[model samples]
Target: MLLSIDWIFIIEKCILIAVIIGISLVVAMYETWAERKVAAIMQDRRGPNRAGVFGILQPMADGLKLFMKEEIIPNLSNRFLFVLGPGLAMLTAMMTSAVVPWSSHLDIKGRMVSLQVADINIGILYIFGVVSMGVYGIMIGGWASNNKFSLLAAVRGASQIISYELAMGLSFIALLMLTGTLSLRTIVEQQQDHLYNFIYQPLGFFIFLICAFAECNRTPFDLSEAENELNFGYHQEYSSMKLGFYLFAEYVNMFISSAVMATLFFGGYDIPFVNDISFGQQHGQNVLAILQGLSLFVKVGVFIFFFMWVRWTIPRFRYDQLMRLGWKILIPLALINMLATGFIILLRNNGWHL
Candidate 1:
């Protein structure tokens, strides 16, 4: 009986992994479609609608084109590391979802079903650790390419990510103090009673949000991939699926980051006033679990749309200005925010709860 139970557990885990990966890929593909549509509207032009109804099939067509294209390797490049770079980029982007708490567990036929792939105690730390490592992919790829422009772009990209990560980490410190736990599940649970951290920590939220844009290389922070200056930037020397991986990994990273932001500051899967509804109470546990899952997707979708909207609306930041924003502005602001939060929390604990 123990062996049978172990087998069942393994099967369930495998199924969960498959579902998350499949959904992530689909979301990444459609993000590309949505981005193009958004750009077209901003530019006052009709976007890709020729391929299928509302241009829904354009991603598939683009995939086929990329697959059929010739794979190129420059003679001077380190072929192995060149290939490994994009693979690492894609892998790190996908790996971040492993710890995100999508929903509370479901009760199914006396068996508990976990909504997350892995509910490690240090889930938020795991996200930060993994995301910090993503810069290596771009750095390695650019350095291995043996091209001056690629190397320059890679250095810029590395510097930007590292600088912004400091502000991002500081922002999380305020949330950590409030929740008193690094586990994302516990953080989400804490928000169910009163308010989201975003309401209390608006300054930190704004800092983190802007830092996220820099980390993801989105405009007005896409200095690393500025086309006119760097000629397509770090992945400039790549072609075929290799180049595709770098680009695809970008959108995937954006989707994952948006999900993380939503989970962290926006209360994950908890809808406002949802506890007052009878549907959540009268229904069985399984039904409530499904509703929670739906809530998470809706939140994630809104965040994704906000990402595209900002990308289209903002202009790229100049390189020096980007550096100044990170080091001179955001860092100092984040430090002040952290100190204030700590002071408030201390006062509250002494019967002066604000």
Candidate 2:
């Protein structure tokens, strides 16, 4: 029975999962430093340069501070749900990475190993489902706090996410119309041989990007956390590592969202203007895989920078404006884009048939 089990595959997957989790955590950590640095540059001030060379160690210091801080649970709060909120948020954030193809497959010894944790057929759907659950964390935490402000912030967050998700899903439907596959790995593979989806689905990508901003609770859609309105927002009652978990989850979600956007719209791990397969044949699979992984990371980095840039540059939207944009504007645009994509695909298919 032991011999029948593919131990090598299991071990490979385990290692991949651990590496991915580590990478996600590290990226999330540095994103805080990057955010501050970017803000300082935009504001013409020094950020966190005191700690370890241009503030590179600032995130570590911040983590240590959070760890040392007292863990406080509000007296009136529901203890079980209060603890569960941040845990659920962090879990959902990490879970999204399971389906993301980090790079092309790497050949280990004689066997080919995929970089993705679970390249399930319903990869995109899995992401949507996980993201949908993330809102529950906010709601539970806020309601458990037994604070009216926290409950209001949670309500705002849940509504914002729900509103934008409709447009985001609709935008994805247009991409699905083009790709005809739900598998993210397959989408990237297709793009390797052709133009990236962004070129073909520009409108869809635009809608998706805007919806992505809203989904991540980034400004100009960050009404839920508007300091003037909600104080500290849904996680207001959390302290110590529990509060850190909520903060970390947001950054992790941003990183994963960047990766997902890169994979969907850009040629994920596909070296631009380079025939990866031929290059791999000329060089070796390991070298090619490393380059591919770097390529994906580079794209992800650019997207993350863009996210930070917009957050610093833009102002938060009014609650009414956010709802209007999501329901009235984005949804209609997404619907039209989806219809147009279908029409174009139908025409092309008929032309090919003729």
lDDT of each: 0.89, 0.92
- Residue 77 lDDT in candidate 2: 90
TM-score of each: 0.96, 0.97
In model 1, the worst 10-residue window by lDDT is: 272-281
* Candidate 1 C-alpha lDDT tens digits along 19-85: 9889999999999999999899989988999999999999999998998999998899999999999
Q: Flag regions of model 2 displaced more than 4 Å.
A: 1-4, 352-354
In model 2, what lDDT does residue 33 have? 97
Off by over 4 Å in 1: 1-5, 276-278
Candidate with maximal TM-score: 2
Per-residue lDDT tens digits for candidate 2, residues 216-304, read 88878877677775588998888999999988998999999999999999988898989999999999999999999999999999999
> What's the C-alpha lDDT at position 21 in model 2?
96
